[model samples]
Target chain A: MKARGGVDWMVVVSRLVFSGVFVWAGWGKLRDPLAFADSVAAFRMLPHPVFVSLVALGVPVLEWMTAVLLWVPRWHRAARWVMTGLFALFAVALSVAQVRGLEIDCGCFGSGEPTKWSVPLAWGRAVGLLGWAIWYGWRVRGRSADQ
Target chain B: MREGLREEGLRMAVMVAGSLVLGAVVNGVRSDSVPWEYEPKAQRMSRELARVGIKEGETREVAAGAIELGEFAGMVREKSVLVIDARAPLFYRMGHVAGAINLPREGFASFLERSGLLGKDKSRAVVVYCQSETCEDSRMVAESLRRVGFTSVRVFREGWRRWLESGEPVEKPS
Candidate 1:
């Protein structure tokens, strides 16, 4: 019983941390879509101007929604899933950019500040976040089952 | 399982739609709109170039303000234009266009201040180039010049590669 309670506490703590990170990151990107667009371009993903522009506009909103959803108990599970997908997507993009040896900013936190993209560091962070999301999913599922 | 998948898909769609609507609202209602939608088309080209790592050897189709190698050389020979090398100081020191001045991106502002190019006629043709076709450093430097009121700024797409290929005169750093 004690171990289960401890696990429940861990889940709640991780949820708060995840929600805070997404909110902060999303707010920064939303305020400076152009800078975020530049970072997207640096990733060289779509390479098409129109698509890149759409992504720059759309991504931050999704991030904001994910953060909001995490705070709502009924939608919390869905938020974890969304975050997992987002982290996985970021990890893949970072990996590709690193493999191609592109010297550009991560645009992770938006622009104006010089934050050069580092593949290793970004991947490590994304993977860590994904792990947290998974743990959140597992613990929340068990908690519900117990109820 | 089918029901779960359907629910998940619906949730994803709702999230995507919500984001789009919010973004559209912000864009439509604001006069101080984001630069992505409001900046000049020419200014946006720099964003496109910046995205791809602006490599060392690939030549892009010449855009309206892009200058090819031969034209760049002719302008240099005419001595009516300023050629700014956007490579690092070390690379500029190794070799550069015979009359080109080093204004590496890292130290561009200070160099611009010291060089007095800002006070020069803004209409004077300024050509910027870096290591190769893929190098975006030149584009960035040219945009910086444009922002400072230079009316005629162009990029030498082939940059150092074409300059060397044509055997144009180069000067070693003093």
Candidate 2:
């Protein structure tokens, strides 16, 4: 019982950390949509300017909402999956850009000078986040079953 | 396990739909919905140009000097023009056209000193470029030069992409 309680506490802490990070990142990106779009455009993954603009606008909002949902115990299972999917996509994108030898800003937090984080480091961070989300998802599922 | 996966998938789908609607709403409410129309960086670049004594009337000349890759290459060969790469330091380090100096748009002021551009004659023909046609750092840097009293500044609108595609010689920092 003590072990189970400790596990639950760990999940809660992870949830808080994830929520805090996304909210901060989303708010920052929302403040400068054009700069964010420019960073996205640098990857050259998206072909259309309009689509890039839409992504620039959409991603922050998605992140903010998902972050909020993750904090809600009842919604944790669904939100965890969304966060995992998003982080996985980010990891893949960063890896692809690195492989292509394209130098680009991650645009994860907002727009700034040349990315301080190397491509490998950025991908690792995203993958790490995805792992946390997966763990949270499993924990939430187990909790529901216990109830 | 299968039932849980199905439930999670359905919930995720609903969340995705909700997020899309929310994003659309947030974007619509923001002033930057038009993208290019509201770049604060560009505005700052214009202001920086103004600081260097360029007036409103002279800005027309500043904006008119767009040049093609071939002409830019000619200027490089004939006039030995100073070529400025207005991209981030990392990108600049990765690769750049031969004899080009990096002076990214945001850090134009500091780079001006570091690149020894301030010591050169203002009348010397100068060319500035960035990533590609879609990128505006080249234009921004060109305007900065013009405003700083450079007598001749040309923006290579096609920028790095055209130069690379044309098989122009490139140099990476050693």
Which predicted model would earn the best lDDT?
2
TM-score of each: 0.59, 0.58
Extract clashing residue pairs from model 1: A41-B51, B54-B134, B55-B134
lDDT tens string, model 2, B1-174? 999789888888877777767777777787656353333465556555555445463222235788887878877766588898988787789999888889887656767767777777999888888887656678778877777778888888787878989987889767
Looking at candidate 1, what TM-score does chain B attain? 0.62
Evaluated on chain B only, candidate 2 has a TM-score of 0.67
Question: Alpha-carbon error at B123 in model 1, in Å?
Answer: 11
Q: Which 10-residue window of candidate 1 chain B scores lowest in summed lDDT? A: B52-61
Model 1 stretches astray by more than 4 angstroms: A1-7, A112-117, A142-147, B31-139, B143-174
Clashes per prediction? 3, 0
Candidate 1 residue-wise lDDT at B96:
92
Error of 1 at A6 (Å): 9.1
